[model samples]
Target chain A: MLDNPYHNKTLQWLAYAAVFLLIGIVPLLTDDDFLLNQLATYGVYGLLAVSISLCWGSGGILNLGQGIAFGLGAYGMAMTMQMQSQAPGTIPPFMANNALETLPIFWEPFWNTGLGIALALLVPTLFYLIFGGLMFVARVSGPFFAIMTLAILSALATVFVALQPYTNGVNGISPPTGLVIAGTKIDPYSSTAYWLVFALLLICTFTAKLLTQSRFGLVVRALKDDPERVRFLGYNVAVYETLVYALSGLMAAAAGASFAVLTQYVSPAQFEVGFSISAVIWAAIGGRGSLLWAMLGAFTVQGAQSYAGDAFLNTWILILGFSFILVVRFLPGGFAGLAELLLGRLASLRGGRREEFGQAPAKGAAK
Target chain B: MANALILGISIASIFLVAAIGLTIIYGTAGVINMAHGEFIMLGAYATYAMQTYFGLPYFLCIPCAFVIVGAIGFVIEKLLIQYLYHRPLDTLLATWGVSLVLIQGTRLTFGSDPKYIQMPGFLSSNIELGGVSLAAFRIFVILAALALIALVWFVFYKTDFGIKVRAVTQNREMAAAFGINSKQVYSFTFAFGAGLAGVAGALFGVLNIVLPTMGTGYVVQAFLIVVTGGGALMGSAIASIATGEMQSIFAMLLNDSFARFLIFILIVVFLRFRPQGLISAGGSRR
Candidate 1:
């Protein structure tokens, strides 16, 4: 009988689970508020990263306009918070600056927190539903899909900049006072905010894990591998693509909400093409197919940029650009694949025998 | 009204020149060349460097700009893009990186502030046609753009090299099997495209502020035009002028932001109905 002590897939999953748990608690162990705050920001970015991985990796749909979804979420949250901070029945600072005498029609519904969150998630989802439905139904894929999403992003940014009365143009909207939770004020910069973000990150990751392991995930993977084959099997490929795209947009909105609560400000600059491209870089740098790796990639890349300070700050774009090149050139499987490759090599060195773990090691390694 | 027409034509002329180059390369190579805008930036900077730093005459500096920037494009194709043709996404990523590097490099070499390109004395005066007055330079820019287009048309439709280029664009492997030098044609075509963008930049440098970040905005507009025009050289030329006229007329009637929103909505709707574009050349996968 073959020695199979190390062949349990559950143990492999547990190992990944443990790493994520440790990452979750790192803020609690550290006493530094700044570090904790940074971790919280990374948690928000992690949420977005997971969103990208879920749709792009599993569905083989690379969305280059994720920033728009993030912007929708941020704006939704910011509008609500702004409404709350105002004296009851008074115009908010943004509206006042724009010389609006009365509350805008759209701002009326966002007065309630529940409605705000729902709108934040629903707006991006609906936007994707219409866009994804049209594009997916037409069988748009590859570079065409990338370009179309980019066009949508460009249009969205332009609209935000042009609609100064509502969006404050380039000035963007600011967060209200710290988040109010059941009569207790929670300072966004406080440890409590960090814990809330941490909880959301965990929930997002678990949800993504559950999703990727489901039958739907299998269908998505199947479509990625061979669209025609999946179609022949009587699967509605367009529906699958649209659902994944909408789900990804929803997750992106959630991340944006967390970001607004954390940063307390939202701007048109935040939704630039560069921001969308950065999400792609994050997913590309992390192994695309793996959720934990995507989060790790987001955290590590963003953390490095944050710690690098002003001198290295301007060079961040160049660094990201080159990092993307290097990753694409050598580490086609991204960091996760690199790690798995190293582990495989180490395993081979330990015993002069080949071992198989979780699907084929080579399959899905190229992203 | 005449001045508005002149201004619209001048704006359309600059976009037409750049868009034509972009369409040619995109159609032939199936490469989007995200760095196409960077070439325009390079041209603008090259002209600035020659005129300001080297003390060259305005007329002499413009052609120099084209040559220098075209050379850069040639080098970029041979060193970077040639290897990336197999992987379209990789090309997009790598060129995007190149664009960032070029923009920052320009910002570092020349300060982030906008630079001015002085117009020659002859091209500076206003000429009156009927009751309306138009800048002499604006008329000259339109004429120059038309001349360039005519020249390109002649080269493509009236020469063996053009035939080979079209053949290669239609089928690269088949062209190679037929003993056509497809690689050389690609390099030359890319260089030609960059040269056109350079010319557009040189002309635009006189009409507008030349800044490192200016390329991004224009490039996005050019991209929209290319997609709207059906990704063909003729399509881009006609669509660019039409789009410019629409934008200009809309701007006259409405706020700039509202006009922009209207155009965006129209493009989105247009794309929904005819994803292949108004004048698709039949080879585009989209």
Candidate 2:
């Protein structure tokens, strides 16, 4: 089942290492803080794309609430930084404006950076565990599961906006500057920040890839193929799915936290249904079943979006929508599949066995 | 209490129109169109274009919107949905792309500015019953919804095409074996569904601001109704009415945002217990 050329274990790890090195050195290669920030943004997006792939591609659960996970991270960190940006003892200005004499109980814990990060990961994971667990145990899958996640995203976005005092309304929570952890101040556009994001991206990618290639991933993929058969084989399918979903939420939260630091803001827009759907598109176009390809696809598509924003005033969305359709319809393997085909052709010309490397024995390739 | 009940029925009427199209498309083709909302958006745009450029009356815009959107749906079904019928997920993704194209394309042409359709003077006024006052437009919406539902019921139950559609929906290969052109039925059914969305859009344009993103707002509710309804006409009708009434009652008791949040939560929990929806069709692919 792992015979796909893109699933070549050594080649994948090498690709992972190579991509990490390339992105890690990008800050050093460029002195422009703007470019560095953009790279950091892409890295954060890469983390998000990898999260989507981990759950949807390998675990057979299409989580469209990924933006909520990402936004929870951003909101968590933003709340911390927003408090930190003010004087030590004063309530957040927004809370004061809302006529509160003191910080809300929820906001009190986020004042600590460590608590912020922990909450970022814990909140989203717990959300996924409850939500995904309920759906999975109820035996919801396929289109029904997909739409339910979308509902979560829309509902979350709305709830964020409606909870004005805590969420700062639709204007969102924006700290004037980057976060301070212990005695270290994080400057968002600085090389250090870029490296931090790059490091997080690397950690997320490697861990996700490792998970998807592991025995647990194999069972998840098998379960995705036929849940009843896996159940017949004595596996608790819902538990495995819930675990992977929660793990994906953890990764998304981490990305979202770092993303807030990079952007210096957290808006309800971050939790928009469109934003979550974009993550799905990135995974789909990257190679839904492959973590490495999905990460690359995020970078590639986001890079194109950034570049296209400058070149085409409004046609970029049209082009993106069209490409998304074309990819789903004609190029189901996405850019990763195209790369695999090219590599396979090259290997075949050099007298290698094409079938073993080029074509996966089954559609579930990563496992 | 009567006022709230009346308000709920009015809200339910609009949702019923929006959800009916979705139910038909999903019930017939088993395609969960992500672009369903976009089609409704296009219908509003069509109405706006007709009223502004062609000087078509607001009442006349309904059929015009329906025909134009239905034609677009026909073209889409022929060009794209036809190929994706075998893959439900692909249909979801591809239709999402279609929605993006529709939304962006509309934005490019019409810009992001909100547009409105001028309702007739009567619809613009209010009627008093006892001590309660209701907008004439809301009553019109309710009557229009009832008319459309009746039309759909008549079409589906009292026509040969309806039988063909039901047959094809139940078993495509068997229907084909019985000399029914399932493909044609699918195309017609898709077009009909799109037409219903167009009418919904036309009505919504008056009820709310008509913008490129308006469809999304309605589409979410439509989805809730359709999903809860289990993709059937009767189911959608009942679900929409129940949801609308509950939303109104919730809003009356709590604030609007909290009410909506509660509804969304309830729907999710409801789905947990009844994933097949309020009613499940037998022989459905489990």
Candidate 3:
């Protein structure tokens, strides 16, 4: 079934490694803090896109409220960094500015850096597990699952905006000074921060890619194709889906935590439905079935937006919306699909007999 | 206390109008349109354009908005949605893309500032009964909601088009086999739904600021009603009334934000126990 050019094992791994090599060597080429920070943001977004691809594309779990978990991670680290920035015996600056006398109980645990980071990952994981377990066990799939997550994200954004004293309201809370943990500080606009984000993105991409190549990954692909068939084969469909869903939460939170450290802010706007939907767009543009391409999709779109923000301003999003429609309608495989077509042509041109799987249809390229 | 119930019913009516468009499209065409909100937004924008340019009365703008937005919807379905009748997920993504285009397009045209539609002098006043007090416009909105529900009922049940729509919704191939042009039914149904949303936008423009992004706020609530109602007209009405009342009462006890949060959680939990919703569409995909 894995006879297609997109799933060519050796070539994919090599391409993935080459991209990481290029990413890792960027710092050596430039001392521009602005550029590094921008790239670091891409790496964080890359992690997020990969997670979305893992669950939404591969596992067939359409989670539209992923930004909530992303926000949870951002807030988790921000709470710690916010506490760190305060004077001894005083509340965080945001809370102090809002006239809060004591820290909220939830914010108390985040004062310690370790607990803050741990909770950043742990809390979102638990949330995904419980939420996914509930939905999947009940056999809810497809559009209903997608819409529910969208609703939850929008509801959470409203709640976050309302919790002005705690969430710092619409303007958001920023710990711009960066984070210090165990005597080592991760500066917001430094090579160290960039390297950290870059390294994590690579690790996450590699691990997730490997996971997708495992036996478990095969089941997920099968499940995505036909959940009933997977279930009939004696596989616990809900457990498998819920597990991957929780893993996606972990990855997203990690990215969010890094985002907090790199950007030094967490806002109610980050929890907005648009934020999560854009992540979906990135995954879709990159080809959701391929992790590397999905991350690259984030890099490409976000990079374009960042560069085009000033000149185009209003027209950028209008054009982007149009592009998204075209991609959805015509280019379902996205950049990955384009790459696959080229590879297939190259193979055919060589007058070589391509490995043909007897039972696999051409549509099952990723299988 | 009783005042809250009155307010709740009023809010429920508004939600029902906003969601009816979405429910109709989903029911008749089996589409999950993410651009449903944008269609409603276009409706409000159409109303605003009429008032600002022609100095059209608030009451008269409703039908104008309906026709303008519904025509746009009809054209959109013919051009884009017709190709995606079988793919719900693709339809959603495509509609979302359409929504983005519409939002940005409107923003480009109107700018981001809030616009206002002048209501009649009587609607600007308030109606008071015993201890309860509410805006005359709010009361007007409530009546308008009821009118929309009744109008929709009449269309869906009493007309030949309704039979065609229902036939296609139940079984598309069979409907097609029975000399019913399912495609035409879908386009008309989509246009009708869009018209309803346009009316919703015209009403909502008076209640809130008429901004490009206003549809977003209503859209979530609309989806909540639809999901809770199980994607059927009767179910959507019952769900809207129940959720609206519950939200209002909860807000009375706590706060609006918390009340909304509670409703969201309650819906999620409610769906867990009954994924079919407050009213299931039997074994059909709602």
Candidate 4:
């Protein structure tokens, strides 16, 4: 019997490698720009899922406002890219739309692409780290953390929209042209954007998997299960928590930047409550416990959305809403857990094991 | 400045009414009902239905919304929330699912267009006192909030049913052993909370636009108040007033949205320093 197939790292890596190989070769086989764009967006979404898995799944810090970081990243990338196309003296498009004559002081820094990218990732990471640090150091655990993040989510949703001149309000902001790197211009629909996002997605998942497998990851898991006990064991749980939260924010911001490049648009829409909640849903569905599965979970949901198209968006939400409930309530371990269970079943069947009644080992099914 | 204080109190009352239901459910049952906002939305929709379809007046629609949304809450408790007790994280996610379903369902039923509730002509007018002038509807809302809080306080302290609820709140296992049906208490408490949110929605519908998504905005405020208050009636009462005054004062000092951002930042700092809140819901196992 496969007593615990989930912890079998070899099987996980094999699956991951196969998926990565498939993503790599698909572009070579396909000529459709739309397909390439969609896949690129999915790759960015994979980063979002990986972030959630790291924080909520692995670190036990159910950050409901991860999308805030994602939006910040998108703004960072889009603003920097937008500057590449505009005149040096001119204001940002959104600021100009509001009839502001002078470019905002903040926008000036983003004109330098390297500084913008670094700031985009670092700022959100710092924000999330500080926020998580405050909450955890004060011993705010579980639902309180969730509630506070949720409050941040709703607040950011409004705050982003309220900052219309900067965010361009509901209409959203897109760069007038593709980002020019050296002599190469990267169009969102091109194979280059697809490969870039796909590479980042891989790097993010690998880094997360490494972290989760290391001693830091061990403490993170312990922190999730019983934080007080972890603290009692003389571990600085708050530092561990803050680090993971910052890491999650960094990953989310990277994905958001990828989104700005891959989709060529950024807006308050990314800061909406729906976007934040969807991150949780993806992690939940994909198997928050497994970093790879969580990324796939994002891919699965985003793929479904593309298939369904924008017309039935509400219908998609309705379906995901029900799935979210059922998964959380009945299938807490989600798809990865289910896969492990099925594998265990198959192993038992193949092994012809005759375990005594009441002797079946608990598989840690729903932690 | 006095006018702003009154307005702050008015906003405070609105927050209290909005949060009372959430406090009751979380305090007693320990379920952080994320769907609490959806119930608020349902309440508004119920009031709209009664007024538009049944041709009922706004005054009568309040009770109708209470009953209607409360019944829905009861059904939801029986079907889903019952399975989720003691599992706080699961309950949070499940209730969030419920909120999503409720929001999309409402949007599907009501369409995306904004709906309006017709209040009486008197409520449409403004009341003048000294140098202050405020909407009569605001005064009505304040009175409604006070009346609701008083009634909830009375229910929790004055009745036999209230004792059962308090017992359950203190210790569900002990309450069960003492022959108090804790499940029944939970069901009733959840229903009452939902009904309170219904009342909040009915009032807020007039105060803001009646959209399918209106509850999203209020839910954040409601949550902040509930947490700051430490999930007790008096805690919520004091917390709401404090939050409202801070918000009003910040708004007066800065721009409106800037004030909101500052309030959020302040709330986080406040919670970081005092996660147990201004007043803890004491003598109970969290």
When only the first chain is scored, the TM-scores of the models are 0.91, 0.92, 0.93, 0.93
Model 4 C-alpha lDDT versus the unseen true structure: 0.86
lDDT scores in order: 0.80, 0.86, 0.86, 0.86
Off by over 4 Å in 4: A97-99, A309-314, A354-367
Worst 10 residues of 3 chain B by lDDT: B277-286
The digit string of per-residue lDDT tens for model 2 on A1-367 reads 3234555789878987887888777877788998888889988998999998888888777776799889998898888888777776788778778777877788888777788778877898899899989989998888888888888788888888888877788999889878888789988888999988888887788888777778998999897678899999999999998899899999999999999999998999998888888988998999888887898899888999988767995899999999999999888778877888776655445534446566534433332
* Model 3: per-residue Cα lDDT over A144-186, one tens digit each: 8888888788878878888999988898888856799788888
Clashing pairs in 1: none
RMSD, one per candidate, in order: 3.5, 2.9, 2.5, 2.3
For candidate 2, write residues B1-286 as lDDT tens digits.
7777878898899889888889889877888888989988999999999999999989899999999999999999998899888878788889999999999999999999999888888789998864668889988999998999899889888999998988898888899999999889999999999998999899888888889988877667788888888887888898989988888888899867777888888999999998878776435654
Provide the global lDDT of candidate 3 against the true structure. Answer: 0.86
lDDT computed for candidate 1: 0.80
TM-score of every prediction relative to native:
0.92, 0.95, 0.96, 0.96
Winner on lDDT between 1 and 3 is 3
- Report the C-alpha displacement of residue B228, candidate 4, in angstroms: 0.5
Docking class of 3: medium
Model 2 reaches what TM-score against the true structure?
0.95
Each candidate's interface RMSD? 2.1, 0.9, 1.1, 1.6
Q: Give the Cα error of residue A72 in candidate 2, in Å.
A: 1.0
lDDT (10s digit) by residue, model 3, range B1-286: 8999998988888888889998888766778888888888888889999999999988899999999989989998998888887677778888889999999999999999999888889889989955688898888988887888889889888999888888888888888999999889999999998888898888888888888888777767787788788878899999989988988999999899889998998998999998887766535654
The DockQ of each candidate is: 0.48, 0.78, 0.77, 0.73
